[model samples]
Target: MSERIITPRNRGFLFLDAHPAGCTRLVNDMWRSVAARPAEVLGEDAPVALVIGSSSGYGLAATVAGLARAGIRGVGVSFEKAPTERRTGTAGWYRTAATAELAEQAGREMHFLNGDAFSDAMKDQVADLIEERFGRLDHLIYSVAAPRRTDPETGVTYASALKPIGATARTQTLVFDEDGKPDVREVSTEPADEDEIAQTVAVMGGTDWERWVSHLAGRGLLAQGFSTAALSYIGSPLTADIYRQGTIGAAKAHLERTARTLDARLGELCGGRAVTSVNGAAVTQSSTAIPGIALYTGLLRGVLGGDMVSPVDQLSELWDQLTGVRPLETDEEGRVRLDTWELTDKVQDAVAERWQAATTETITDLADLDWFRGSVRQLYGFSVPGVDYSASVETDVAWPASR
Candidate 1:
């Protein structure tokens, strides 16, 4: 067994290390899911594709699915911090490293670019790379999440906060004690003001996504019949005011609106399609930071009869839509509803009943708290079945060799 060093960061919400065994398990598990789920058809122009923010969460899963299922030549852009002696960087870094290594073994093109996805330089770099290598893109996926953004036009930075707008939202939240056991608790967040709402929209909105489409389309880098998507979430009513009706929701409204414009623009340019997909809520590092989401996801899982899909499965379904194996199912707003099951009336009714009755003491019984906690741990590369946590792990690891 190798030596291991793991320390909590961000109040135990995050950890820093590379448990080789754990990370290897995680990578292989995702790889298996990707390879297992087959796509309905191949891509165009040797299936050259690009994914912005493709290091973790939905983006990472979609990249893996592209390589293993869609047989695409993949290019991913991310801003993951590199590993150093003091820490092993983010789990996303490790995920990309492992994925790049696998792509090399399979003799396929998989380039993972580490930089700011929102930067103009990064966009130019991607255009240049695509022009020099494959010359065209067959698919694009945007799944970016940043805490703040400095608008290019205004030179002002805006940070997004999770809070209600019209009223104070009190909801059940999850907290972990020193022992790593989760306790459901209530948190109160006051309303966000006009400035706060605008800032949140600026940070999390679709300006950058629109920017990417304009650049790519103008440069003629996207191929004909290309399919593209951006991931968003509209959770159950348990925390609607704080999520779907709050600051983040306002940003999402912008995103969905942007999607409509992109859909038409892409169709004209290359007969392509673009839509913002409403994905189901799951345990992501970003989502965990939200106040009421943990409690909601917990109760959601229980209400849904213990069925929970990861980013892997969700993206695979998107792949199915892109490939025409499964037809698109859209809501009245014209947004794709890949979160088909989560939006079912049966599930929402059950969740509403459970959430109404759930207090801190009863939350554990009402929801899948154990699974929720485990999923959170899994995001940071802990709680895997075979990882020897006691053993020291290598902290200073090299980035994956040429993808």
Candidate 2:
């Protein structure tokens, strides 16, 4: 192993390296949190699940909870860069490795496939693995967050653009100085042109999800009571122009519609079900890139405080919904609403007030910049407690094989 002292390196919001020890710590925390919940008796037959994009954010949290809390055997697929002798791997790589190690200690059957989830070859490999080992798929979680996707059949690539639909969106957002100090600044995002909007939808929309389910069905891999969930987010008016009513929103709209169509098809296919889970805002790698999300989430953290539901908490509840431990709660459109806490009138009113009052001078007072900063660090395996940043670490960490 090539060992070296590693610290956080970043270019604006993009992180350059990840610490394996810190990634292990983050996964351990997630495991402990799930273990703290009252234990469930998953009898002799436990569900087999497949989680696409199961390396970070909601997907990673769901994998942790599903194995540690819900007692499920599963497969997780993600695309991450493996570490070289001179470079550290992506955070998701370390996180996936750590999660696999912990799952092994817990005596769980967790397999991992590291490749593009949108590719036909990847889907075929997963389907074959399920057929040979697991027999059937009980649950499917689609949580992919990608910038671009190449259509396997058409040989064309689509790149997602994060911009408004009809008009330019202007807002006071968060920016970091060279020293990594946070400050409020105004940023304007131009609207996406027609091609960009279509491309965004192509990359981020539900067509890929539909393809996955369809492929699994063709393979006769869906179980009697199979269920699928695609993670989605709907921010409030503060960031709606760049979020809920934006290019990403158009993709999300298609995702939700696909869920409806899938729900109807699955209802007939095996008494199965499908729904889009609208998760609450939290510190995620994807969220930090959006135009106004940093300011909005910072204000949200300030206002919600103890009431905030983490990705782990929300995904644990999602497991509960899937396993029949509790009733599945959904809105009129049949979408699961996990953002209720963030959207409550009491919370939004306070957040909106702060959003309007926020400026560079008052940003510290108006938002939880500290929490946001720390959370973003935790995403890339930095700022984690008990990890010695000064110590030499193995840059070439091996990803554990499927068990």
Candidate 3:
């Protein structure tokens, strides 16, 4: 494989020139990052799992890693519009194929479903397929990060905005030039209305999650001890204005709330077993799109080791909880707090103080920048080991027949 050039352009999206061998190497590297530890023993009969949005980003990678770690065979459902004039395959789609192929090589059974996850038709198709193939599903993972969604109740599609709360909010961001200097650039954002917030919540929030659970339960397809989880993030105050305090934040709050309701419902079905995981912040494609968060993540990269727990690690932890190997502890509100250790007062206080000083000071060390860049690269399939960059690659790779 020839060396592939990868660049981050306009937030979390990556512009890549890839080779098949490089892509394979990338997937292998991700698997090695969280290979099972001796302390963790998967059940002899691994449960079948389904991962919606299991084509790219944390969701796709986590789906692969979770299945592998749990020693489970499962299917992944992703929406990648291709062969429709666009003629493009989503990064997740290609990664899903790579992951499935890798799993098969290890003598595991995996399947992929490609379509719009929010569609009722797609959900029905998945439920039917699961009943036909596996007869029952033990776990479901919802890791979608779509910016726009059509409202089922209102019959209108709404797109999420990345601007700030007011008519004009200016914030400083890092602009990486050819020389890789963090040039300070000011960004201004526009405000949104109440309708937009509600609509965005309806689509991007936890409604679809609830519907999936209800549909499966209604059909009597869910197995006992079934576990489902959706990932959420709460960043620093600098990002809170645009993230946790903005329209997206409102949607996440809805997700957090909906988890409780879903937990109660699933508990009745599965004997008091269901969970929601609030994961720690790393450079994910979705996280990068949030205003001012890239800078914050970059700073965190400097403080934490460059190898801040990978999505593979997060997935392994999720599987541990799902398989009853590690019991999940909840907060007072009955939400799974995975990052409670990272979100402690001391950690937040230290990061906040560093962020305040970094804004004014000249912190241009490679060590500091590696904190962010490393995390970002790991989010995508880059900088992983065993990839042969000496050969040529293609960005347009296809998943298996099912995907």
Candidate 4:
């Protein structure tokens, strides 16, 4: 049988050596999304686009929705590594490969460019590729995430830190056990210093998003009525300290501020708009590394009864809203709240009681730990349903011919 490795961590990453079984499951998941919400092309005048971080999570969903539903012919820029004989391919690689295959079947143009989205050269390359293939890009989706970033212009590197805003706080943190179930324990996190806060903002804030917009606009790359959106998260009050009020929160605040500013500028330049969408929490590779979010999400699944909303659902909904079909309802700051349902009083009141009552021993009774573990497992291409895990599998997944 093919093997995997899931190590336990308090606030560390869930590690695993993935098998080909996981890849097939992911491919099925992608198809399942399209099947569930069949894509209806935006129109003959649907915008040509550029999607950053377009291989996984929200980015991948947006790409699928754009091409399959909206008929957006554009380039996808991501920093995913290619798979080798000694290891199975990265999930993003397989997802992108699957996307290319699907796009080819539809006779749509879906080009994949693997590299750093923060670099000037990568930005220029994306612009050039879009010009070469389909000139005048209209839609832009910025969904990139990284632990560290080096400013391409000034050459300043900043690494993000996940710590609470105030004093060191102790709470139940989720980790994966050897049996691949949710393991909870009490852990404390130190507050971020001023420098750490600055660094976090530098890495995760809206500077890069602004840079991309300004560059694209300066070069006359953006189309009239161009629409751009970046993904952000503002969860329930339970995680406010660690997420919304933490360093990441400060960065998001900056991101929202930038979005509003860019929205005005985009209108001035070309009858365009820029807005930030607050997404729902799920067990992504990024969320698993955070301290309290995993346990909270697991408990949330219990509160909502096993039907947790996936990133694809959120992206698909957002796509429908932003395609000029349905008007977007926004706050005074012009931020779209896709997380509204996840934060309703009904959901939060239940989660609040569970959050206070949860412990390592009582957590399983309160939350569906198995589902949480499965969610994390799926991130690393393991624990997915309906794959032949016992059979010998191919390690090499080919890059798409279109790329």
Give each model's clash number. Answer: 6, 0, 13, 0
lDDT of every predicted structure (CA atoms): 0.79, 0.90, 0.68, 0.78
Question: Scored by Cα lDDT, where does model 4 land?
Answer: 0.78
Which 10-residue window of candidate 2 scores lowest in summed lDDT?
A: 35-44
Compose the digit string of candidate 4's lDDT tens values, residues 92-211.
Answer: 887777788777777677788888999999989888887777778888999987999999978988999998877786767777655555567878889999999999999899999999
Poorest stretch of ten by lDDT in candidate 3: 1-10
TM-score of each: 0.93, 0.98, 0.87, 0.92
Q: Cα miss at 76, model 1 (Å)?
A: 0.5
Rank all candidate structures by their lDDT, best first, as comma-separated numbers.
2, 1, 4, 3
Off by over 4 Å in 3: 1-13, 16-20, 37-44, 81-88, 152-155, 163-170, 359-361, 374-390, 394-396
lDDT of 2: 0.90
| 384: Cα error in model 1, Å | 0.9
Best model number under lDDT: 2
The TM-score of candidate 1 is 0.93
What tens digits encode model 1's per-residue C-alpha lDDT throughout 1-403?
2235675344656654545456667877887866444323343444788888887888888887777776668689988877765566678887778778776765568787888887788889898888887888878889999998876667788899899989999888777777866677778999999999999988888888888888887788988887788889988777788999999999999999988888888888889898888888888878888888887888888887557667777888887777566787677787888687887898888888887887767877898877777777777777877777776676555666543
Model 1: colliding residue pairs: 3-391, 3-392, 3-393, 4-391, 4-392, 4-393
User: Better model by TM-score, 2 or 3?
Assistant: 2
